[model samples]
Target: PLGMVMGSCVYHIAHQRMGAKIGNIGRNVEIEQFTQALYDARELAMSRMQAEAEALHAEGIVGVQLRQHSHTWGSHTTEFFAIGTAVRPLRDNHIIERPTMVLSLDS
Candidate 1:
């Protein structure tokens, strides 16, 4: 059986110091917290999608698509969505065989 599975997560970005003043010049650096928040949000969404697939008794999921969007929510808030097709094997304990290599005599 083949079915569709999906999951989503929402996160809010927090305010952080934009720059550090050194004497007279200001230096800007990457915001570690913001990067971490993005990673967390994506993981949460993927996990939720996987759980849904498990509930469907699916052996695996394919064609996974991850997306991010912000609707209605303010600029600081973003939503992460993960979707995939869940598929169940036709037979239990099925064995997959590797393909044999063939060589051409003429080249």
Candidate 2:
């Protein structure tokens, strides 16, 4: 096959606590509040990913994706999903060993 990238997609789950108890059979009453909570949680997760990338001085992220869903069954919560690869510029140097600052997932 030609050159192609096979990526490992990771899922990050975000949870939000509405604080209020889930009323019996009345999701409609709290739908708006629940939605806002989920939004806040997802933003938190995104901020974390960006901070991590900056710490590594990545040029950009590729194959990034996100998802959201509410917890079910015994869990009883909402979740946000995010995934991406942190990348940096590659410079061809005569040095055989990469510098200590080089970011490599295999390391």
Candidate 3:
């Protein structure tokens, strides 16, 4: 049976020093906190989606998509959503077909 699986996560990130703060003044500075928060959110969402697939006894998931939403959640908060289709193998042993090409000597 084919099933649809979904997982969602909401996270609140603290504000970090931005441009022209007190002692920080740069053109483009990377914010480690924000990066880590996004990474964590993605991982959490993925794990949850995998768990849902397992509940359905699916072999694997296909067409996975990860999306971000900030619906009136303010600047410091964001939401992550993951969705996919769970599928089971038709048989124990399945073989994939590969295409072959032949070259001609005549130019």
lDDT winner among the candidates? Answer: 3
On residues 22-84, what C-alpha lDDT tens digit does candidate 3 reach at each position?
Answer: 445644766788899999988899899999999999877887899998768487888999999
Task: Estimate the Cα RMSD of every predicted model relative to the unseen true structure.
Answer: 7.1, 12.8, 7.1
Evaluate candidate 3 by giving its C-alpha RMSD to the native, one decimal: 7.1
**Model 2, which residues run further than 4 Å from truth?**
1-30, 73-76, 91-107
TM-score of 1: 0.74
Colliding residue pairs in candidate 3: none
Most TM-score-accurate candidate:
3
Tell me the TM-score of each prediction against the true structure: 0.74, 0.50, 0.77
Per-residue lDDT of 16-101 in model 1, one digit per residue for the tens?
Answer: 64453242255466667778888999999999999999999887777789999876757777899999998776777874343367
Worst 10 residues of 2 by lDDT: 1-10
Better of 1 and 3 by TM-score: 3
Instruction: State in Å the error of residue 105, model 3.
Output: 30
